[model samples]
Target: MTDMPDNIVMPFEIKPLGVRGRIVRLGAVVDDILHKHDYPAPVSALLAEAVALTAMLGASLKFDGKFILQTNSDGPVDLLVADFSSPSGIRGYARFDADMVAALKEPTPQALLGKGHLAMTIDQGQGMERYQGIVALGGVSLTEAALGYFQQSEQIPTRLRLAAGALAQRGLRPEAWRAGAIMVQHLPRDGGISPQPFDSGDAPEGSKEEVTEDDHWVKARLLLDTVEDHELLDPMLTPEELLYRLYHEDGVTVYPAVTLERHCTCSRDKVGDLLKSFSDDDRAHMNSNGVIDVTCEFCSTHYQFAPEEVEPAPEARAQAQ
Candidate 1:
């Protein structure tokens, strides 16, 4: 593993094979976002997984825009949202029925989201049409659901392992939360090749010298399964080290890393502009105690605006024409 800080996405490719993967470990950034809301353990865990997924998927894209992952269901967790901005920024939030969640001893992803669909959206800024893919949530964990989406929507062989939890240290006043995930994908190769013999000694017994595509994919998946939950979430484990530990036998090569940060697009000016769309009467009705307070759900940032600030000035309106 390269010597660097956490909160980064490291890309790697298996040499001589059409396979690619990424490892992401998030620390302070995830802790910052989750701390804004008072969520139960189950809800917090789900949201952390969402955030990690967002970072992994977003980093894989080459677009300079935004990627969003969301789920809506009738279960205790009504909504889960995570968005990643271009370059490297991620934020996530969840809404759940407190009483219902509290009643359960342990809640799984499927239980929290009883019946719902997972949606992924990519927005490439103005003049470009946004793309979205939806798949039914059939898996028990978020990682499985994501793998299902890749299989059904893109027909790509993919594997993902995600883990999140609070880390307790001796002198820390409060436990620090962290989330991490690793993803591996098999890219299509041109033309067909004979089934090649395995030299790693990990392949199935009596395998033919000519290896088929399925054989390669199966080998990659098997290697991925060897990764333990602790290895992925441990802050001490660097991405390079983790990848080496998993795919060293397969010959892994690390690419440049992308750093991630916690950021919210919401701001006072943006909120003010949204309120300006309303008429004077509507704006007046929205005011409370002569001030309109808007709180961002993703980051819990509060923006207050006086009625006058929301109303466009005469000079500004005249300049618009």
Candidate 2:
């Protein structure tokens, strides 16, 4: 494992098998987003997982746009959203019933989001039509749900491992949050080039036999299953090192790394524009203490606007004139 300087998304491929993968390590960026909200450990950890998954999956897009992962459910946690903008910007937030969440001893994804639907949306900027795919959340972990989405929605064979937690270091005011994820996919091959046969000899005991493409997928998944939570969340482990630790025998080839950062696109002007769309009466109803206060859900940034500061719509302006 090489020493990576900071938050990065590293892409890699195992030669001759058409298997591609990505490893993402988020450090200060995740800490920045999660620290803004005083979320319970489970809520914070789940949101961190979403953020890491967004970065991993978002690296595949060839367009300059935004990728959003969200879930809506009837359980204690009703809403969760994570966004990845083109060229490596990410932010996320979650909403839940505080009392209900506090009572959960082990808040797995399913427990937090009972009967929920996970959705992935791609917005290719203005004028381009957005694309979305939805799947029922039925897996033990968010990683498994994501893999199911790709298999059922995109018809791609995918495997993922994700982890998030806080790390304690001596002088920090609060423990820093860290998140990491690894994803591998078998891209459809052309011309019938057989998948590079993998020998199961290196696999741990009690592993299933491998013979065909499906068997190869099983082998890959088994390898992924060997990853531990600590390995994923460890700040010192570089992507290269982690990949080598897992697939060094298979011979891993890593590509250039992409840096990631915590960024929120919300601005006072955007909030004002949204407020301008409301009818005069509606805006008046939203005002408190003679001013309207708006908070961005993604970043919790507060914006204050007096009625005069929000430019009225053209029709409203014409009527006023």
Every candidate's CA RMSD: 6.6, 6.2
- The count of backbone overlaps in candidate 2 is 1
- Full-model lDDT for every candidate: 0.83, 0.83
- Local accuracy of candidate 1 as per-residue lDDT tens digits, 1-321: 555568988888885566788888998899888899998878888999899999999987787999999998777888899999989989999999999897766688888877788899998999999999887764356887787777667766678899998888555437878899998887745644323233556767877356455667777878889988888788787888888887778789888889999999988888899888767777888899999988899999888888888888787667654
For model 2, where is the 10-residue window of minimal lDDT? 191-200
User: Candidate 1 has which clashing residue pairs, if any?
Assistant: 1-241, 195-209, 195-210, 195-211, 196-209, 196-210, 196-211, 197-209
Residue 73's lDDT in candidate 1: 77
State how far residue 164 of model 1 sits from its true place (Å).
Answer: 0.8
- Winning candidate number (TM-score): 2
Q: In candidate 2, which residue pairs clash?
A: 1-241
User: What TM-score against the true fold does each predicted structure earn?
Assistant: 0.87, 0.88
